[model samples]
Target: MRPIPHPGRPGKLLRLLAEKYPTKEAVMSRLIYLQGQLVLPKGVEHFMSDLHGEYAAFYHILNNCSGVIREKVDYVFGARMSKEEKAEFCTLIYYPKEKIEQMTAARRATPAWYRENIARCLALARLMSWKYPASRLPGLIPARLRPVLVELLATRPEADAAQLAYQQRLLASIVQADAGAEFLEDFASLVKRLAVAEFHFVGDFFDRGGRPDAILDRVMALPEVDIEWGNHDVLWMGAALGSPACIATVVRNSLRYDNVDVLERGYGISLRPLVTFAQHLYPDEAPIRAAERAATILLFKVEGALIERNPDLGMANRRLLHCIDFRNVCAVLPSGRYELRKAYFPTIDEDAVDPYVLTLEEREILDGLVTSFTESPSLRRHVDFLYRKGSLYLVRNGNLLFHGCVPLTEDGAFCEITYDGKKYAGRAWLDFCDQMARAAYLYHEQEALDFMYFLWCGRLSPLSGREVRTFERTFLADKTTWEEPADPYYRLLDDEETCERVLKEFGLSPKKGHIINGHVPVKVKKGESPVKAGGRAIIIDGGFCKAYHEKTGISGFTLISNSRGLRLLAHQKIADVRTALADNGDIESVSETVELATIHTTVGDTDKGRAMQEEITDLYNLLLAYQNGVLKPQA
Candidate 1:
């Protein structure tokens, strides 16, 4: 067959391909490999949203792949393994080092026990390999053990007793070589990596919970991960950019939740200065409360100034200082005056020309915090990772993954918002916010820094659907005034037409595409379903934050999209790691299938697959160049 030359084939690009491929045979081999990969089953995807720094719960869920590991153990062993044995085995896989320590302490770390568990882990890894390409497994395993694992996995244990004996010899060799622990760790790691092809953290990986830093460390260690920047995440990002308002708000939230460990120890940020200042400033109140009050006042003052400087933010009503009747200790709202709950404004100069202006003490405290937040190595590392791997939204394999809503009006139209003399709504608004957020980090421009705070709580911010009522909730005695109304997007969640409109706005098909949302917790206790818009939209934030357990009626929700279909796992509360290890306790999850694949999903059907196909085409073009003498192939 005569090779038809592809038009506009740049010589430099073809030459670069030639250097890598070398010869026609090399190009053909790569093409064959890619084509084979195309037919492989799509890797499983685990979608989690609104983790809210619940590290222990996040740890278990992530390690267990939302209980898929246990389910697979059951599928593999069935009646041969008792329920207790399966649980123990699964627990070992989930927490290899801890389980090993437990077993060792109990005098249960027999050579036989190690061999048996290692064999089971290998079996599980082999089962997981069925969904992945042959080449993919080696990268997940340690280099030294890759060859041994591949050999053992190649043997059919069930079909051949001789092969089983061969596997037994390998396991025995590992134990005899004092490599049992190492092999088990690698196997456990391999199995977990294979359990989920990719992890999608839809957002809110900060706040409420005690260990967002630890959570970030775990997430950073994962093989594949993408994040949609949550409101809390952006607040931290803005703080990292040295925005005083954002820094104050972050400190306030840490104090409010009593989760300052993430700041003090995790990020090495000292709250001692603030605590001391608070103690001396408000000597009558308890230490923590005093500090929190100090933070709240600082937050309001800085946020109020930020709002005042930017009239475009449309947050004039949120300026709590101006609205406060300090003498009467009342809030002067648009409706009427309301009594203050605490009436504590010790730092405020009531007689000053501008109440929003920060006092000298407050200014010093905020400057220190901004310096700490921006200069802390750990905080900078984590926030940089957020910038590298996170975005406003991600469209992957036909689904729209975002942290919050597409701002919509009550009438189902995209809410038009004017900012910086430009009108934006829907996709454009999200894009603009994302750009400004990045600019805030990269350049620290005043407008971009201010916009970062706006994105944190602006009524039109896609990340924050509801206006934050921090001031009202903190000081207002009237519970009615504390109610922060949600954007119309929340009200229209169940409307299939609205979902379709949103999908269309993002250039996704309504029939096949889903809007995987976060930010709002799914109130399962109140008979609320995570599935909405007739399966067109799904809210995966079942609230991983322990504080929301009572309100959400579950630990969290995780969406698993694999070769066969899409399913949501509503995870029940996990007591602790001790309970899980000692009692063989697992987070009892209720699974709800959202969509079943019409055909088994393959690598050819995924976004990555499309990119691979383009590479294949380029290779074919290179092959034509070689045949036609347009480009010479290297030997």
Candidate 2:
């Protein structure tokens, strides 16, 4: 039947919908389903920040969904299942492929066992996915397996005889098709995905630990995620975009931590050029330590080269080469004149106009490094993912999320800084910086590259809120010079008014939202609090790296936002994942409720809810047009 469009309907959009819906029935069916979904509990989100590589810990936490599996196991089986049984079940959920392989190889699990395990996992997944609408589950499941999974999960308890018979026939078919193990593995993944509806990686997925790319591999596969770029993350980002200053810093750190393989092997970058140049520059090296020191000197030269070319970098303080008294092997630094340690001056030619100038070989090596960073497919792909799913900061579900400070002055005002001849601070400034990051990658512009380096180390940068003190930390004997002053934002973080102002600046309601931050490791053992501003802001970087364990007193933390409320999962330090798993120890976890909702939060209260509401309104209008003869219904 020919129907008239609604008087208020947007023409082009309705036309698009008309082709898909054909008639009002399709749109009405979807609207009815979506409306019902709005009443369901909002899915839980698992938040982790400052991952800093630590692949074992990150991978285990991700696979386990930050102890969500254990909690679910307890909820599903409780005392009925022995501790041993529960532990094995958790293992299956975490390493389904590996566990299945072991069992199959050992002939420990027969076909009957696989069927029983698969059935049990499917049953438990039903409870885990209870919050998500049934329609959504099919999307998480593999297409070929979806029908079997849906049928098994939908089996009614009342129809025991028929359900058992149907289940038996399905199990037989699955076994015959050799899909029993694959089915179990897929079901286990479904449980993990359902348990953690979204992964919010607040920031810092690089440096300080090994195997960051492993986590990156998993993060790319996640259905929903948003990464707030931390200082370290930006450093890598800048390097990946071919910034020599950032590349040098990355090399120095990677060499210092014995993780250059992460850059060379993992990212398919060749550091052999740099090694050859460093060897040529400083010949009489003291073996291993000399290689490290010589490599660091190469980095200094590269960094200095950039600063010399562009004084706008404002890195006069970083001109440490000028302080080098080549003859005496001592430095007259500003803090205090002191002799240098391991004072080697093979590359510093005092007679030269530019001491930071790279040799022909060094330049060649740098060119190679830049090519590796810019041309490698994997490196390009990872950085592209960062651009696609990352932001300087994220404002979601009434909460403000940023990796570092809001960059406040001593008096608790936004510390303004100039960018591209315009002064920027607060939200507008952050947006501008984020835009520059996109421009940096998209256009490969020099100013964008320079800005990316600045974002990595600029003291006034919101991402890097403190003095880097790289030179001082490296060579100076005076501990005083090594002290990098914190931005005034840290002091103001405890002030309610400041928090409110900051929240309002980000266009979030001060009364309704909280600030979630990660940058500095929270010193939980020193009587310091991660929760500040009377719980209006929270810091979740609980020293994910082993390096910070003694200083911050925990391995890491996960901030969970579920239907019930927000909670913090403080994890006990984990030294080894395999040992912990074998012992059924998943980082002794303690959960503390942050703020419980008055009533459990439903999908109706989310940003997604607003989207669904708009869909409902549109569907209703479309239905109205169909009934009122305002628009022609598609045949």
Candidate 3:
């Protein structure tokens, strides 16, 4: 696999920009354009976290841009359109292709229907395009339809009778030509692009809800996106990098959640070999449980092996396979001896020389699984996407975005973690983890792979602040023994001083910089607020997965940051796509203004804006170089 290239350093980038704009005239023209863009309202950013493979809900939230589209619909149509009419119109924008197909199939898609919708779509696009510059609108529209649509959007159709009639004729021509569906699809794409300038997926795009693979496919199609690696996401990344423990854990999780389809249908990884092996070895257990049990054993074995090889991973305590007494059907732990959930361990022999070592059959099954996970084309594409777009943490637009905690010690300081004979904490540690994760994929080294697995559940891993007691939870009958304590970071989250320290460590303004994270669900039903540290940090995981809904008391949360500052949208349950198309079913999102910008924020105030300023500076230099005869212009 070709390694993904990192962005050039500032000097290198400036050199490249200078080369691109050779002449003084070209440099001046580019500088003027970029400078002009600085004052415009920065596009709205939509933040969602812990999607957990809920594709339908994710798709709807993404299409509707967290109710921003519906709000725009209301703003556009107002009292002229009734409630039902607005709902239908919004539904059309959300699922234009599907709605068009539905109408055509029902024999209700008349030329007049196409003309009306086309007009409405144009109106909505015009409204959305206001947030963006006119120059940017053409790029947002479909290439095939850009020339015609750009002309229509240049002026308001309702400005004069001539303009209105010309627009009407254009709409009619589209309908007459029977290209309304294609036109509407393009319009929908344009509107969606305009509605949200960027999407920040703050982690956990994999596991639980059955279609993380589908979620990734949708995310990949978006124009701009950044992902903060969640623990579950890192597990899959590790698996794709050929970590045997990670692969086993991925499979075990798939089986435990009854999400076998995600493995077999989604990624095309065959579970047949493991299933046949499990069923033959443990015939009395249900097939799924048997497979899960088999995978769990394989997981422990590999984890144990990894721990033994790399004692620095700090997971020696997790090698509990050696503590199990087969005859007694119990495991000795620090607390006490606990009875195993299932005594039938056909593959385990406590009397063996090394209990953590995989048996011949287990080894073959794991080797097959590793091959399947590492070589699956679909899985590779998704993992590549993750690596290309994801990191352990991100600092964007004066805010910090990460999937989990910053790893704080009990004394409210950044937790010091030792890795590769060096101690690192806070941002440095996360950066190291990110590099190792990339190295695991790029070099496929055993140490890097082990570190990647550690990021999934290591105690000090920024992605997973909790100590996962998978062994205890799976085998111990005592519920008391199953408690997995979270790191002190969780306890310190509500402390303003602690949060400020974290912000400062990341080189953000502690006074203005807010930490946005997701991993643990915020239980709203229990009167818990996602906002913590007096609103300096916000945890937006409200549970998109059905399994977490009961615990979180909300379908999901979306954070929107636009010119006006940040607001959070708490969504209720969204109906399936069928209902969305047929009945205009939409997720009802309650919006709360988290921070109202004291002054309207412009593109000049953003990270991108700062980068643009650098380019403008470079252009000025290039112009000087050309004028001084230091560099020649293209003839």
Instruction: Highest TM-score: give the candidate number.
Output: 1
Backbone clash pairs in model 3 (N, Cα, C under 3 Å; residues 3+ apart or in different chains), count:
0
Residue pairs with colliding backbones in model 1 are none
lDDT of 1 by residue, 31-128 (tens): 88998999999999999998888998988888888899999999999998999999999899888888998999999999999999988887788888
State each candidate's clash count.
Answer: 0, 7, 0
Residue 355 C-alpha lDDT in model 1: 84
Model 3 weakest 10-residue run by lDDT = 1-10
Candidate that scores best on lDDT: 1
How well does each candidate superpose onto the true structure, as a TM-score? 0.97, 0.94, 0.96
Clashing pairs in 3: none
lDDT of 2 at 242: 91
- lDDT rank, highest first? 1, 3, 2
Candidate 3: lDDT over CA atoms? 0.88
**Candidate 2 local lDDT, 1-635, one digit each (tens):** 23234685547776677677768788889887988988999989888999998998888888888888889989888998899888877888788887787777879778887877887797789888789887788898867688888888887755788877887788778878888888988898888888888889888999878788888998999999999998888888888899877777787788777787788778987767666666665677533344566666667887676666656556667768777776776778776687666565676677787778776666776777777887878877888899899999998888899898888889998878764477887888788878988889888787788778778877777788887777767776667777888889988899999999999998899977899989888999998888888889999999998899899888899999988989999888552556644555555777888888999899989989889988777777677777777677877
